[model samples]
Structure formats: C-alpha cells, structure tokens
Target chain A: MRIEVHLHPPFTQVVGTRTLPVELPDGASLLDLIERLRMDYPNLFPSLRSPEREEEVRSFAIFVGGGEVLPLSYKLREGEVIEIYPPLSGGVVPKLVQKTRRLIC
Target chain B: MNAGYMGKVLFVDLTRRKTWTEPLSEAWARRFIGGSGLGARYLVELSDPGVDPLGPENPLIFMNGPWTATPIPLSGRHEVVAKSPLTGIYGEADAGGHWGTALKKAGYDGVIILGASEEPVYLWIHEEGVEIRDASHLWGLDTYVVDETLRAETAKTAVTCAIGPAGENLVKIAAVMHDGRDARPAARCGLGAVMGAKKLKAIVAMGNRRPPIHDRDGLMASIKAAVPEIKRLAESLSKYGTSGRMTTIEALGDLPIRNWVQGAWKEGAERISGQRMAETILKKQYFCGACVIGCGRDVEITQGPYAGVQGAGPEYEALACLGALTVVDDLEALAYATELCNRLGLDVISTGGVIAFAIECAERGLLPAKVDGIELRWGSPEVVLALIKQIAHRQGLGALLAEGVRKASEDIGGLALEFAIHAKGLELPAHDPRAYNSLAVGYATSNRGACHLQGFSYIFERAVTLPELGYPEIQDRFGVEGKGRFVAVTQDLMCLFDSLKTCKFILFGGIKPTHLLAWFNLVNGWGWDLDRFMEAGERIFNLKRLYNVACGISRKDDTIAPRILTQRRGEGGAATNLPPFGEILSQYYEHRGWSPEGIPTEETVRRLGLEEEAGKLRAKAVMKV
Candidate 1:
C-alpha cells in the first residue's frame, strides 16, 4: 500500500520536502508508519519522537484525510494522505529567546 | 497593604469634571482577584442592570490584575468592562500591550469613568495626577494619529489607549486600540462606543512607579526556572505567531469559511496563513510588555498595491474572519483590510462577521445588488475594504452594519436572522462550534456572549491538558461524556486567567493550575491552595452570571445561532458532528449548580457567597412577577 505524507515546517525543513510517498504493508498501523519514517529519516525522527523519552511521540499533531485525529492503532490503507503539524503555541517571544539561550548555553 | 496592588482606584465623573481617589477594598480584591472580576463587582454595585449602555449612567472601567506589570511572563494585559451597547448584557474585553503596564506604573490599580463629557476630552495620567484636557483637535482622527499625537504632546514614553472615527461615530463594532501601531485592542462587546459616547478621546499613562512586591526573589527564581521550558514549548508560536495555526485550524475544520457555510477551503487557507505572511510581508515579531512568547507579527507591505500597510499584522482570528469567512484569498488585500480596521478602531471579528452577513444577504437578493455604490460580492477585496470604511463612518449601507450583525439582520428582516451568526447579540469569533463539541456549550453559556476566550475549553480539546482539572491527557473533541463538567471547570480556570490579567497562551507553555496558584500566592502573599484559588474563580464566574440574570437573560437566551446548531459542513473534519447541544447544556447547568433555566440556584448563591447578587436577581424577579 502507498501512503502520502504532508509535513509542515519545521518538519518540512528537516525532511527537505513538503510531501513524500512511502510504501507500507497492507493493514499497517499508524505506528508502523511512524517507525518506518523514523528509520528512513533519522534527522527528522528526533522532532517526531522525544529525544529524552524515545517511546513518547512529541506533541506535534497528526491528521488523516479530512483532518481526523485517529489513534496510532488505527489501520492505514492504500492511498491514505496524512498531514503533520508542529505544536500550535500561538505566540513568539519564548521561541526566539529560547533559541538564543540554547546557543549561549 | 497588598504587595502586588497600588491600593488606589481613580474615579472620574466627566459630567462634573471631578476626579477622586478611593482606597482599593482588600475584601473585594480578595473575592474578585482584580481585572474582569473586580470590574464586574464594581459594575454591579455602581450601576443598575438595565442602564442605557451609551448613556452617562453606564460606568466605563479599565482594570488591571495583580500580575499586571509584574515580572511574571504574559502578565502585560488589562480588562475593560462595561454594559455592552452591542450585547446589552455583561460585556468585557481584554487586551495586551504597554498601556496596562503604564497604567499600573502610574500608581492606580484601576480607573472608573462615569457620566459623559459635554466636550471632547482626553485624560492624561502621570506620576503627579490625572488631568482632563481638551482633545477637540484629536477628535475625528484615526487611532494611529491619535496615538502619535498624544505621545508627542505628552511624554514620549507614554502609551495611549484611544478610539478613532469608528468609535467617534458610535459604531457598535468599534475597538479600543492600545499601543498605537502595535494595535492590541479590547475589541469586543462594543465597549468602544461607550467610550465614544463619553466624549473621551484617549487615555495617556506615563510614570515610573512600580507596585511593591511581596517576594521578589522568590518570584524571580520561579520565573527563571519556568522560562526555559515555556520558551521551548512556544517556539513555533514565536516563529509564526498566532496565524501560524491557520493551516492546522483549517484542517481540523475549526476555520469559519464563506460566512461558515462552506466546509473546506484548502488552497485559500494557505494563502493567508502566518507562514505565508512570514514568507512575504512579515518584517519582525512584536511583543507585549513582559511577554515571553511574543506571538505578535509586525508586517510591512513595502512594494505591493498594499504599500505603506505596515505594523500589527493580522492574527488567527483576523485571518479566518477577514480571509476565509469572506472567501477573499488575496493575502495582500486582507493584510491591508486588517490594517484599515485597526486604524479605524473596528473589531476585526465583528467587522468580518457583519460584512460576511451582508454578502450572504446580497447573494440571496435580500439586499440590493449594489450597496453604497459598490457591488456586494464575496471575495471582492474592494468590497471588504469599502464596507469597513462605511461601517466605521456609518455612511450608506455601513450605517446598518455599524449596528452589528444581530440588529442589522433584524432590520433587514425575513430569513436574515438565519445568517446573523451571533450569540446574545455579539458576533461569534472565528472558531466554529462544530469543530469542537465543547465550544457549543462554551459559547452558549458564556456570560459575555459567544466569546471563545471566556472558556477556551477548545484548547484542552486540541493541544493542551489540565491535569489540575483531572485531564491528564487531551479530551476527545467529539466525545459527549463529561464534557459539561469539563466546560464548567475550564470556564472557572479561564476566569482566573482573565482576573489575573495573564495571557491564556501560558497554558501552551505548560503552565498549570499549580504554577498559577504558586505565582498568585507569591505575588499577593496569600496562602491559597489549589482548591481555594479555583473557588475564587467559580465565585467570579457566578457573579457575572448573576449580573446577566438581573439583565433578564435566561436559559432561552443562552443559545447560539440556529444555523450553527442545525447545519453541518457535511464534508470536513467536523462534517458529521452536530454537538448534542441540549444534552451538553443540561449537563453544564448541573455542573454549574444552576437551575434548568440557567439561573444560579439559591443553594449555589449561598455556596459561592453571592447572596448580594442573588438578592438583586430575586428583587428583579419579584418586580417582574
């Protein structure tokens, strides 16, 4: 089965493309696809999964076709399109200041 | 003396041209916790329930909370409360900018203005005192010019909260603009019209005083420990501001499109998104005073047809309302329109709602093909821009729209109310109830009408979790179980946020009830536990509801538009969910301890120590009977 993945920034920056195609076994769970992406894109995996807690996915939201937020156990089928977004925090000072602090520290 | 308060409230009578200072009541502060809560308490005591909102009897209040102007992150906000000319009920609005901080520094916790000035005037508040000066020249000016001219005439460091032609003309959708070009607005409930009716042009605050702190070192240490995590959690917001969530919001079916009749507008959503703004006209990020997450955008359109359209870029609400709701996909044009609304001191959400409502009326032939010499068509940038000016100046068809959607639709008559899209007279914010089941109940029971911020229960349904409120994980947006209890709890929590004048975005930074309690205790030297803190919130919410009940609001009035309740998008993320609204509302009433008619029960009033308010309600009920 083939699945289409749409990534928003900063994931797009990490993966170097907004959309990508992946092949998966029939009746594959959503977690299986995440595992596949983790192995395929090592640099992007850190953002998808927590660095400190490997088993825990980061707070980034994932929506299936028509914006349904299904669980990881949900089965994926042929021609499924998945959209991923960064955490919607809705403000600016904290991020820029944090980035600067990271560089300094 | 309270450590975090100035312990003084300034009372000005415009009719008598008299100003007096009264000691802030410690008992009232303890019960209300300042800002909206305190303002509401004062309003209930000082004015009757059914006073004309634009008349001299209505009190216009500007209030700050304990956290305001302190070193606490996201504490630079204030609340404006009045009898709404738009809703005719408990009306309040919140804004973030330096104006609140400046007011705090000027050595007052709040200002209450009564009576109307016979002539145009502006109040200059400084370290010395307040002076009611002539502002005849400042009349009829845009907010930008008023701000600049006020600062130039006063201290350069002073900040001004002013109204423009929209407010001057008594436009019901007018906003009270703060920080000049940065343009933070207490932009709902038609409070600006109240300010205009007072013939008060601007409030300029400049001073060097600071409130005494109870535990400065402890507060600083806690803030330092919390800052790193907050910054990390809110990094995306800092990068893209609030408009960053446009694509995701659209994907989730939360974005209102084509006056909320359309299910999806994928390509159109992307064009007006924050990412698109960053890629195009975003010049820099703007920040309110003491904000750790500066989720404000500063944009400059230096070279387009929108050249000279600079400062205070549109946020998520503006983008959705002015862009998607109208089906206007032109980003540059929308940016210009947003700027124009700010200049004219209009509420973008209400302005967009009225314009979108007018377009639908025209499409159905309920209105003439051309209004005020401009063709009324959806997606026409010129129409949107022209309508904004018309509404602000109250000229032509703009005169009707200036009354806001509810009244305008009533005047238009016949099936127009079906498209009015408001709750208790105030236009709905950009978020649709279909997207989140909780929003339906949240909007309906909100004391100040269909305000998302009043509850913000949708945040828990989307990203954040409130472990303190028993949600260790995100609640199911489509689930019906326990949602009534959930909405009630979150509304109480949000009341604390508003009363404290802290930005709600702190929740996105992982700030919990415990953190908020700790900060409150530290700042005020109060030994309040989590339960006690939450009880205060409940008391505040109930008091406001009691005020509304006195104003003749009942369970029948606690409703949203019929269109929103009955219609489904039928094709998006929220397509099939209609929100079992009746069930949720029943559960909400039970959780809130209110009667089936949505009135606070006698037992509830006793529990919350609101017998005084309940007495008022009983008196009114007896009079009616």
Candidate 2:
C-alpha cells in the first residue's frame, strides 16, 4: 500500500520536504510504518523511548487525516495522509550567550 | 535580613502627592514569598472588595519576587496586582522586561499606589528618591510613544512601564506596556484601565543597587546545572518563536479557529505559523531581560497592504486571536493589528476575542452592518485595525467592545451571550479547554477570569511532566478524569512560579521543584524545603481564591462559557469531547478544600493561617456573617 507522509515545521527543515509518499504493505500498523521510516531515515526522527523512563515515550505528536490523533496500533489503509511533528519544547529563549555571533547573527 | 530582598515597600499617594517607604516585614515575606502572593496580600489589606475597580480607592501594586533581578534564568519578571476592572475580582498579570529589574535595583520590593491624581503624573524613581512628575504632555500617547517619551525625559538607562491611550481612555481590555523598543505588555485583567483611572501615565525607575545574594556560588551552581537543557530548548524556540507552533497547536485542536466556529484550518495555520514570520517578515528575534529562549519576534512589513508596519510581531495568542480566530490569513495585516494593540496598550488576547465576538455578532445581524462607515466582517483587516483604534479611543462601536465581550454581548442582546466565550468578564485566551480537560477547570476558577497562565495545565497535559511531583510527562489530554486534582495542584505550583516572578518557560525546560527551592534558600537564606515551598504555593493559591470569594465569587462563578461546555469539534483530534465541565468543577472545588459553593472551609482557612484574613472578609461584609 502507498501512503503519504507530511512533516510539520522544524521536521520539514530536517527532512527538506513537507510531504512525501511511502510504500507500505497493506494492513501495516502505524508503529510498523514508523519503524520502516526510522530505518529509511535514521537521523530524521528522535527516539520514541525516553532516556530517563527506559520505556517508549512520545516526543512528538502524530496526526492522521485532518489532525486526528490515532493510536499506533491502528491499521494504515492505502493513500491515507499522516503528519509527523517534531519534539516541541518551551517558549522562546536560548542557553549560553554567544556575545560575538549569535544564532541570528 | 534575608539576602534576596530590598526589604522596602514604597507607597505613592497620587491624591496627596506624597511618597513614603515602609520596611517590609520578614514574617510577611516568609509567608507570602513575594510577587503575586505578596502583592495579593497588600491588595487584600489596603483595598475594599466592593471598591469600584476603576476607582481611585483601588490600589495598584507592582511586586517583584525573590528570584527577580538575579541571574536566575527567566527571572526578570514582575507581577501587577489590582482589583480587576474587568472581572471585578482579584486580578494579577505578569510581564517580562527590564522594568522589573530596574525597580528591584531602585531599592524597592514593591510599590503601592493609592488615591487618584487630580492631574496627569508619572513617578520617577532615581538613586536619591521617587518624584511625582507632570505627565500632562505624555497623556493621549501610544504605549511605544509613552515609553520613548519617558526614556527621553528620564535618564536614558531608566526603564519605564507606561499606559497607552487605551488605558488613558479606560478601555476595559487595556494592558500596561513595559520595555520601550520591544514593548513587553502585562496584558491581562485590565490593570491598565486601573492605572489609567489613577491618571498615572508612566513609572520610571533607574538605580545601580542590587539585592544582596546570600550565596552567590550556590545560585551560580543551580543556574549552571540547568543551562545545557535550557540552551537546547532555547535554540528550538529561537528558530520559530511562539508563533511557529501555530500548526502543531492547530493539529491538536487547541488553536481557536473562526472564533470557535470551526475545528480545523490547516492552510490558514501554516500561513500564520512562526516559520512563515521567520521566512517572510521577521527582521530580528527579541528577548526579554535575561531570557535565553528569546521567543519574541520583531517583524517589519516593508510591502503589502500593511507596508511600513514595523514592531513586535504576533505571538501565539495574538496569531490565534487576530489571525486564525477571524480567518484573516493576511499575515501582514494581522502583524499590523498586533503592533496597534501594543501601541494602544491593549491586551491582544482580549482584543482578538472582543473583535471576534463582535464579528460573530455582526454576522448574525445583531450589530449594525457598518459602524462609523466601517463594515464589520470576518477576514476584514481594515475593520479589525479600525476597531482596535475605536476600542482604545472609546470611539463608536469600539466603545462597546472596549467593555469586553461579556458586556458587549449583553448590550447587543439576542443570543449574543450564548457565544461571548468568557469565563467571567475577561475574554478567553487562544487555547480551547475541550482539547485539554484540565484547562476547562483552570479557566473557570482563574481569579482573574479565563486565563491560561494562571494554571497552564495544557503544558502538563501535553508537553512536560513533574516527575518529582508524580505527574507523568503527559496526561490524557482529552480525558476528563483526574483533571480536578491535577488543576488544583498545578495551580498551586504555578502560583509559586508567579510569586517567585520566574517565567513559566523554565518548567518546559525540565526545571524541577528542587531547583526552585535551592534558589530560594541561596538567595533569601530562607532554607525552605520542597514541601514547605509548595505549602506556601498552596497558601498563596487559597488566599487568592479567598480574595475572590470575598469579592462574591463562588461555585456559580467557576464556570466556562456554555458554548465550550456543550460544543464539540465534531471532527479533528478534539472530536467527541465536549468537556464534562460540571464534573471537573465539582472535583476541583473538593480538591481545593473548598465548600461546594467554592468557599474555603474554616478548617482549610485556619490550616493555611489565613483565618484572620478570612475574618477581615466578613468584617468588610464581603462574606456572610
């Protein structure tokens, strides 16, 4: 089965594209699709397992078909659209000051 | 003496043209923990509950917390407390800028203004003393103009908090403007209207004194420990600022769209996202005092219908209210509207909310088709901009809107209140409670009305967790279960943050309670542990709730708009969730140790050592004898 994968914001910055088509086997679960994508694009996504928890954790949110949250166990049908979001942190600030040349500079 | 405080509270009586300084009580500081907590205490003791919020008898207090003016990350904040002209209850708003730091350096822990000035005046606090100066020339100016005028008139290094024309005209949604160039606004609860009512235009403070830090080395160590994670998070925020998260928030069904008329607007969300601002209009990123995350934006619209519009860009709330809520996809126009709000000293959330409410009313023919020859319609940028001026100037239809959605709808009549979308008189911010169940209770019980910062339960529901407090990183956002207890606990935690004058952004960076406790001990030499600090937080929360109860707020006031409680997204991620508000409110009241009417039981009141304060409420006839 063929499904389209869309990335939002900084994820698009990392992946260099907003939308992409992925070839998946019919009846593949959402986690299976994620695993396949992880193998294909190793550096694009953060790990689902948290370093602190030593178990699976959700760093980014996933939405299916017009911003609906579906479980990873849900089966993926052909031509369905899935959007993968990047890990969002707090509102604006920076760490150490680079007095000479900052990020904006 | 504790290390982190100036131990002086300044009192300025505008009516008498007099100023006095009183040494702060150590016992009071220990119990209140400064900032909003201390400010609330002063308001309770000094002002009457039945006093008109816009009257001179109501005192406006500015307070700094123990962490303020220190090198602690995100600590350059102050709380503005007053009897809310909008909510007619306990009101507080926090702002980040250099003004708070300047005030702290000028040898003051807090300032209380009482009585109205017969003529316009501004207070100048220098090394020697504070002087009430004539502000007749600065009257009728915009916020930025007032800021610039004050800086020019005072020393160049002086930081000023000024009111714009909206405040001067007593617009109910007016917000106090802080910082000059970037223009940070303490834009909540209509405190600006309170200031305007006092005929106070600006407060300029400049000094070189710093609060004595008891353990500088320990404070440095605490900050160093949190720096790396803070830097990483800050970098992410610097890329997009607050507006960049529009798409993600929209995806969660948390972003308000078309004034809560629709569920999803993917294309519109993208058009107004922070990424779009960075690529198109952003000239530079703005940062508050000592903020490493620098989530503020400075944008310039060089060309477009809004060409030459240049100033602070839209934050998430502004983007949601001015852009998405009205379906105005033209980013430049929305940016211009945001600039106008800052200039007029208007709260963007309330401005957007009131305008959206007005548009919804006009669509239903409840309002005139054209007000002063300006047609009212969704996506009409001119009308939005025009109405902002109107609200600030109290002109035409803007006069009605300046009173806020609750009053505006009441005046408009005919099913308008059904869609006004406010908890009390204050308009709702951008977040939809239906997306996160805790937010529903947070909004209903917020002392200053429908406010997000009061609890920020959404952050707990989605992004972060307090593992030390046993709250998992993420709670079930759509579920109604466990929300009441969660809201109550988090409200206390956030109240502590507010009292400390620390920015809530640090919580997202995984700052723990231990870190906060360490800062308090090191700076103030209080030696408070986590439990003790949290108890103070709870005490502060309950005290503010008691203040509201004194103002005649009760269980009936702990309610959300009927539209939010009854309506569902019907599609999208928030679908099928109508927010069981009644159940959540009941649980919240019980968890808060309040009676079913949302009044603190005598047992709970005495346990928090607020029995005297509660008794005062009864003495003032704000409570039943």
| CAPRI class assigned to model 1 | incorrect
TM-scores, each model vs. reference: 0.95, 0.93
The residue ranges of model 1 lying beyond 4 angstroms of the native Cα positions read A23-61, A72-79, A90-105, B616-625
What does candidate 1's lDDT look like per residue over B53-98, in tens digits?
A: 9999999999999999999999999999999999989899999989
For model 2, residues B277-390, the per-residue Cα lDDT tens digits are 888999998877777778889888877578987778888899899888888888888889998999889999999999999888888889887879988898888888999999
Off by over 4 Å in 2: A1-3, A22-80, A90-105, B623-625
The numbered model that scores best in TM-score is 1
Model 1, A1-105: lDDT tens digits are 999999875578778999999999999877887788888888764434242221123244444554776566778879988887655542123333344334322
Positional deviation of residue B599's Cα in model 1 after best superposition, in angstroms: 0.5
The candidates' DockQ values read 0.22, 0.19
Decoy 2 TM-score against native = 0.93
lDDT of 2 at B362: 83
For model 2, report DockQ: 0.19
